[model samples]
Target chain A: QQPVQSPQAVILREGEDAVINCSSSKALYSVHWYRQKHGEAPVFLMILLKGGEQKGHEKISASFNEKKQQSSLYLTASQLSYSGTYFCGTELIFGNEKLTFGTGTRLTIIP
Target chain B: DAGVTQSPTHLIKTRGQQVTLRCSPKSGHDTVSWYQQALGQGPQFIFQYYEEEERQRGNFPDRFSGHQFPNYSSELNVNALLLGDSALYLCASSRQQISGNTIYFGEGSWLTVV
Candidate 1:
């Protein structure tokens, strides 16, 4: 099942912060974050496992709450290059190898 | 190292026709997965291949099929294409053990059905 993302779209000024949320009805084993610029492929940001771990990549970081079946991505001091669509990919079961992505949250960063 | 690579960066086909897309996974990766991404949407998994066999599949219909070769390359074939079939087909690759592993995606093949 596809996950639901909050704030379908967001506009942020450079040096500002923003958060994107992803909620799934199904229990999750792992949560992956990715960003795709216009006309490019989805690029991996980080992954959070079932242990409720938090991982960071540069200015971007994410937290996975297994109990809540949700994950949130935090973009600190957003940059112009941060403009793109952010998607959360969830794995219902470990080793199942299938990742169901969320609808996506469009993030726009302006100078 | 080269990441996942897809063929026919763009294509156009008529409704009711068929089309095939190809993908070569990243180096040192053994498992391949295919996903369909429509405009303004996230990628949806279609199927996964491991050891040259179909290891997993998503909610896609039977009209959508795929094959994986020993070299870990894969193909996605769609029959009786419809306007809705127009989307970007992405090929992702990772280790056979997938869980917790980073899956890399290709540039994707864009298909347009008239």
Candidate 2:
């Protein structure tokens, strides 16, 4: 099943911070985060395993909670280049090699 | 270092027609996955190919098929295309089919079915 994302869309000032959340109904082995700009492919940001270790990529970071089957992405001091749609992909089992993606969260940054 | 590459960046097809999109995986990757992204939506996985065989598939119908060659190049074939099939087709590649491996994506092929 597709995961659910919160705050369908958000606009932030260039130096502000934003949080995007993803929740799954089923248990997940891992959560992957990606950002996609208009007219471009989704770019891999980071992946969080079920162990609850938070992963960070530049100003972006994410955390996964196995018990809640949820993950949250954090973008700090958002930059103009951070404007894009964020997606969370969940893997139900280890080595499944298939990801169920969320609807997506659109983030826009303004100067 | 080429990441992932896709062909026919954009195209148009008539309903009931067929279309084929191509992709080349990153230099050292051996797995290829296909996805469909409609407007304002996240990418939906179509399938994944490894060792020249389809190892995993998504919720798509049989009308969506794919083939992977020895060199890790792949092609997505859509039969009896419909207007609903109009979307951006993305190709992704990862190393060794690892679940947590970083997957690289191509710019995608935009198909507009009229």
Candidate 3:
């Protein structure tokens, strides 16, 4: 099943911060975060495995809640380059090695 | 190493026509996955190929088929295309154990069905 993302879209100032959430009805084995610029491919940000662990890269970080079957991506001090569409991909324990993605969240950073 | 590469960056086809898109996996990668992303939506898994075999598939229709070559290159073929099939087709590649790890995606081929 595909995951559900919150705040379909968000607008933030250059220095503002935001958090995007991804939740699924099925138990997830791992969660992946990717950002896609306009007319560009989706770029991998980071991944969060089961066990409710958190991983971060630069100003982008993500946390996975195994019990809740949800994950969240936190963008700290967002920059102009962070403007793009963010997608959360989920891999379920019973899924057949196929990663399903959420609807997507559009993040627009302005000066 | 070169990342995932896709051919025919853009194309236009008529309804009932057939189309084929090609993809070459990254160096040293043995797995290839195909995805279709509609406007304003996330990428939807089409199918996955590993070891020159179809390992996994999504909920796509029977009209959608794919093949992987011995060189790790892949091709996605859609027969009797419909207008709704117009979207960006992306190819992703990873290692053998594609359980949960980084999967690189290509720039994608924009297919337009009239």
Q: List TM-scores for all candidates, in order.
A: 0.96, 0.96, 0.96
Q: Is the docking of candidate 1 incorrect, acceptable, medium or high quality?
A: medium
A77-98 in candidate 1: lDDT tens per residue?
A: 9999999999999987777667
Q: Per-residue lDDT of A1-111 in model 2, one digit per residue for the tens?
A: 789999899999999999999999998988889999999999989888888989888888999988899999999999999999999998887766567889999999999
Colliding residue pairs in candidate 1: none
Model 1 lDDT tens row, B80-111: 99999999999999874544877888999999
After TM-score superposition, the amount by which residue B55's alpha carbon in candidate 2 deviates from its true location, in angstroms, is: 1.1
Ranking, lDDT, top scorer first: 2, 1, 3
| All candidates: CA RMSD (Å) | 1.3, 1.3, 1.6
Tell me, per candidate, how large a share of the native contacts it keeps: 0.70, 0.72, 0.68
Shift of residue A67 alpha carbon in model 1, Å:
1.4
Model 3 scores what on Cα lDDT? 0.91
**Runs in model 1 with CA error above 4 Å?**
B96-99
Chain A TM-scores, all candidates?
0.97, 0.98, 0.95
Q: What is the lDDT of residue B69 in candidate 1?
A: 91
lDDT minimum window of 10 residues, candidate 1 chain A: A91-100
The two-chain DockQ for each candidate, comma-separated, is 0.74, 0.71, 0.65
